[model samples]
Target chain A: MSQKAHDIFFRSNAPVTVDEDKCIAHKGCTVCVEVCPMDLLAINPLTQKAYMQFDECWYCMPCETDCPTGAVKVEIPYLLR
Target chain B: MSLDNFLNLEQEYDIVVIGGGTAGPMAAIKAKERNPNLRILLLDKANVKRSGAISMGMDGLNNAVIPGHATPEQYTREITIANDGIVNQATVYAYAKHSFTTIEQLDRWGVKFEKDGTGDYAVKKVHHMGSYVLPMPEGHDIKKVLYRQLKRAKIAITNRIVSTRLLTDASGAVCGVLGFDCRSADFHIIKAKAVILCCGAAGRLGLPASGYLMGTYENPTNAGDGYAMAYHAGAELANLECFQINPLIKDYNGPACAYVTGPLGGYTANNKGNRFIECDYWSGQMMWEFYQELQGGNGPVFLKLDHLAEETIQTIEHILHSNERPSRGQFHANRNTDYRHKMVEMHISEIGFCSGHSASGVWVNERAETSVPGLYSAGDMAAVPHNYMLGAFTYGWFAGHSAADYVAGKEFSALDKEQIAREKQRVYAPLLREHGLPPAQVEYKLRRFVNDYLQPPKVTRKMELALERFDQIEEDIAQLKAANPHELMRAMEVAVIRDCAEMAARASLFRQESRWGLYHHRVDFPERDDANWFYHCHLKKDQSGRMVSHKREVEPYLIPLDDHERNAYDKLRLKAANG
Candidate 1:
């Protein structure tokens, strides 16, 4: 076998979740994405729906509270919980 | 590719305010009010509407010196005593004198404060001596109110820009700021006559004991950006050893809010559900008692509220859930704990630098002016000692007015292109790397070292070892890779965190005496040596670009305290019943 550089991925559950049915990101609404202080949420390019892009959520609830359609849910991060 | 090929944007302003959460907004508003003709720009790494420590809004003023309740001199005396007589009384007195005016201004701006039917402010007593804590049962909309005022003042707002370094001129005066948009990675160079740093605390310096990085008592966005920027800009940072450690909810890692619960008859109790401390005011002496109780086999404290009436608990629940970390309700519900039946578990928070809670920040005078000529600082990042949100607003008001007066006839110094060029390369390196270490892993390892080595009960050998590890992390910073602009922002924050960690270690090593309870408790130098260490221990970058620590005398008090008042905080621990 030849030695070469490669990448590995770690899997974890996202604390901030968005409901696909209620998400209005396709309509150009990025309320959840914009309101996040940590900038952890982003709109999925394929689905045009908002999703948690990172695991670093403060669980501050601004995303859920400021969501236009009540599409966002912030759970306590598993490690803290 | 050359730096010019990237999106390099430049703008000019009379004054630039960074970190738009609480103080930055007030700074911009007051600067505009001072001189409406002056162009002001306010920027934040996060959206200005929701940034900084009070992004979700605060529950109440922890140190409101209102008339008929407390005098300015009295409040100053109380703070001076609480901080073990090391505070600059003039700065605290300045905040106390202007505290009511700021409160009235907030009231006029449609923010509600709890007032009795007799038309008097309902002030509650939570401190050891004076009455402060004024509640805002409806303060969740404070950011909305501030955003409205910013728009009304016509202050130019730039959101999602993470400021990396302040640009200084040949005369060593701050002339501009260098930062990049977190979403686009576009470079920004804003020329300004004066710059006000209200960038909150170095809250993310220590990792939470639960091993969660973002689970911090202060907002995770405040990753010591202002402190790092000020230090690199040649500003004196006072009392780096005096760290901010609070009694917070375990695992969840947020304030149990003794100010709120204590007023409502909820108290901090040991495992046996008995009170051990007389006061819940978050002073060093109070935290000392809390640490003693936690360590003396009376471990794992709780906020006892089961004895309170159902209606009072309801009020507590409504207030705690509706404002400032509103998710507290969700965390509690998930754990199946209620204030009516179960006592909410409490634990001491990890250490960080915050003048608002204990006093470790950029040194500024009563006028909010830093040692640097064109730079001003306020809020948690500035060393005003026990300057909570209200002090943030009041000192912000002072910084705004002072910077306005400063820039009256001054011209923007030419932007230092060399500084801009160097910062641009430093910032973009992570994104441009082919393959390397992830920023999160690096941050995790770094913060774990912080907890291991620097979480008080400070040992000299451990801190020295921590410095060696910090130096190793500095090399690790160069290997960080960012897949996107957001990741790049965090990568840069890793660099800032490294700088703060090194500074914390050096400052802790420089101070030989244990003081401020567990904040600077060095086991090797266990006693408080007033004769030898009575002066403020300040740290700054020396001429050789080395971090150097020095001593500065504590300014004489404007309001002298009697011997009894001076030793008041020393008696916070309740004597045993048998004694």
Candidate 2:
């Protein structure tokens, strides 16, 4: 195939953040990940801590509200903020 | 990425309910209750535990026709006037009569409602005429309550499957569904005797003013998937031009929620801190006045609660912060806005299709049956004007029982191999291609065009241009690439959004006259032409697979509304000077 198409990346900040010290993802807690309607959060494999994988947060705040521990924080997406 | 390499899973069900949101869960549970032997499957793109519009749960029922507070006839009349008389009165009346029963059912299921000292249901007056706003102070766990009911009713649920299309048999009746898992990229070919669509509003059709794609008033996950699927299945969609435009908190895009706070003494006011409209009901007329206030140099409307007592402010905060978009409290705090000190700034939201707020959705009858047999619709997606959460539950009960009766002794039709194969190829094409356009970028561009041309104060020429742009976006959709299953779900949604954009433009162009306040406001046709455009404008896919638009006669009124009652919503603006 010709080099007619190539993927380009753009930098964007994830509005949702998880506190490493408070996150219990390592202890098999995926409450935040499971409850996110957008499926934006995930457990980082290397650290086994919950983190936002995708920048597409609705700011509806299910992850933060349903987090087993108070580790998750959802900010207004930067464009809106 | 050949078809042979992919895993295909086939499931058999008596009925499949798409969208495990407010209505889908109710439909599934009620169907199982109606006929325990029937196997029902309830699915959602997100987890059933937290899905759809009420993901974080709602603050109050906007239209709860509880007895003693309001009669079914009165509520029906109110909605008829609010929708500018383009409603199927039988559907509205049916929802009205069953409203109390639905509320009682929720009460029995552990959902709490505010009550007075006399133990009466404390329904508040918020509509232009009736007292319908019933507050749910502890409504944050409404989904949890519904989930418990689902388990008790023995209803099966599959979460994280994004339904793409409805499969129809040779006779053109819906028989099954086609979708893929958003995480595993596995195909779900569900064969069903009946399919109930409860997919909430076409929320992601227009770009929010903030330019954030996901910061939509409706759950961004909705993306008009139900509207697109119903159109493809040849179901008629009513009043697509009557868009859902709400007065939301500026930048935050969620409802400033006058319905919740209005009964507690908060009112929508202009920047001068004076009330402009007489009523806080979210009718199109009320929004027209709101739009006038914003554009007429008295810009930036606010939810005025600053004059309330300190205790009242705290009480407002407790209920508003804890339920229905709880990030609201944080949003206020981030801006240093407090109900006691500063009024929350409000702005007009971008347009979308939602019968829950405005009249634009899949056309269904009193029994929740669409034009296509065996296909039922309910909730925000179904065309029941002003049918909020309570109506969702009521219509859902109707759909469930109707579908339960529909599936009795009805054998599943033979699956179309060609349809399934074609859908499989279309679904996996993005993943098969090495490189192409991204779904998010495509969606953003499409929605931007929707706002540009389709957002009302609509012009004939701009809408024509929008059709042209939407065609180009259709071409762009063919080149979309998805790296994984999650992006693939979004890629499919872009196509859905494009379909809705075209539908919105076509429906607006077909109407030719302005009616529903700012919703169908045509710059060219500024007058409400009830003489010619009194009927409902419906859109659907014709026999040739071409999108077509036409008019349907409005059903004769079940309960007659006097001339004064018919014009009630038109007088929402206060005749007195601003105070």
Candidate 3:
């Protein structure tokens, strides 16, 4: 399969983004990945950060606020806001 | 197919409430009643009938009042004692004083109650409110009431929705919320002066059983969308720690104490059927005070429930049988899917299930402000305010009022685009990756570990191992990828599981002693540990993104019930009877 040009829109299956410096890697991101239920999460080896595979992602966070580390963050679509 | 039109829709309202539970409708209706012609909209992921975990027209009631029988003071003490007094005094009163009114309002709206021919409503015995305990309404019943009210009051009801982001203008205040109607899969731009998140908790995310619905009453629609949405909106949260536990069931299998409480009727047993609670765990006081015989000891200890009095057996049988209701498990859209249905059937169906699942959630003040601005939390979603399980009615009202109050303000500002962009990246980065195990794997491993190590009570060095297990599970979860909505939701359950772990760990570490109901085991701390542990565990969402756990002193109050509040209430009770 070819790599899809990751379009990280809120409504899309894409998970949010990550700023390396800002992430505490507090285990919260893991929750967001699992909460989505669908295999929406794809961890990047190079960045050690989370990114959404839009096509695969379902937009709920099960590992939601459970993480003590608070690494995972949610981004609502700008339009809805 | 185009969500743009919906996304660009700018809507203004006198009040914008997030949840449609018992309290949300009340707040919206009351606000409108407080002022007619107020444009108010109640946004919920599902129908208003099933907004919260618990609804009206059921046996559960906050008003535990019995005429010429029970008193609120005793009720207060029993509850406070069960919660170890971590409950908010004002909050306790808020529920205690207004319970009658809550039921009355529901009744006025056509909520049915199982009452006696004498025109008196019955009580759950355990859930007695002040002077009158209201009847439990079915989730469906509540939806009907809200549907009628919303239509009549001209309140807009948005359904099949999930709020994804909290929109703040240039200033730090809330502008509105970004959400989507899952049924249409169309994103919506909910621009409002303020946003209130009444979506319930991650309890739906915990193990096979979630919250009140654990025993076949699970609400899959209660996906942690609200908590996640609120966290991203920049509102701080508290006590993301402290999930209610009693995820315990009467299933006849497992290893060690963590697996099963063994037998019922005060008997304790292990795998070999030898008496455990009676032989080992039972205290001297228990042996002397209680008169149950502990014959035939091995590993599993079981109180001989057979040949017991019919009435006594019937009571226990009723509780066990009541677990048959399929309302909770069948309600959530996610549970119907193959992956999740297997889970619900496997664990929840195993004979013994406890209503004691969990009662902890986000921490909030009387005003319902979380750690962040332009946001609030409520319901079972709210953290450990008092050690008691606050139902949908209380938190629903609190969050609704708090958020509505916050939004009514005129001050407005815009958010810095740079920070917003950064937040945007944080929110969806995980969805774009290709590598790692699926979120479902992480969810499974989490359930497996927490069930083994951190279930409750016996706090020990074992927690470190559990935490380590969590670490591995975390890595595994980070790898999960979704195939569709079904798979995605199962994965989401993992997120809730992780939160429960964190909350449990937070309380476990801080509370070096055992206390409270259902979960607080004596071997864990051996004492209430009130002096150091009476405070509430406050959790919040930091920019890095999970729970930021902390502690706050539970406000101590006298109410000065002083014989007078008691006398006054007693007289009122009499007057109510006569009238």
Best by DockQ: 1
Candidate 1 backbone collisions, by pair:
none
> How big is the positional error of residue B354 in model 3, measured in Å on the Cα after superposition?
14
Per-candidate iRMSD: 0.9, 1.0, 15.3
Please write out the lDDT profile of model 3 over residues B384-444, one tens digit for every residue. Answer: 3331222345545555566555656454444345644443333233344454456544654
| Local accuracy of candidate 2 as per-residue lDDT tens digits, B324-428 | 888888899989998888999999899999998899999999999999999999999999998989889999999999999999999899999999999999999
Model-by-model DockQ, in order: 0.80, 0.79, 0.02
Count clashing residue pairs in model 3. 123
- Give one digit per residue, the lDDT tens place, for model 1 in A5-76: 667889999888889999999999998888899988988999999999988899998899999899999999
lDDT score for candidate 1 against the true structure:
0.92
TM-score of chain A of 1: 0.90
Candidate 1: stretches off by over 4 Å:
A1-4, B1-5, B577-579
| Candidate 1 interface CA RMSD, Å | 0.9
Model 2, residue B502: distance off in Å is 0.7
- Candidate 2 chain B: worst-modelled 10 consecutive residues by lDDT: B570-579
lDDT tens digits by residue: candidate 1, B381-446: 999999999999999999999999999989879987789889999999998887888999999999
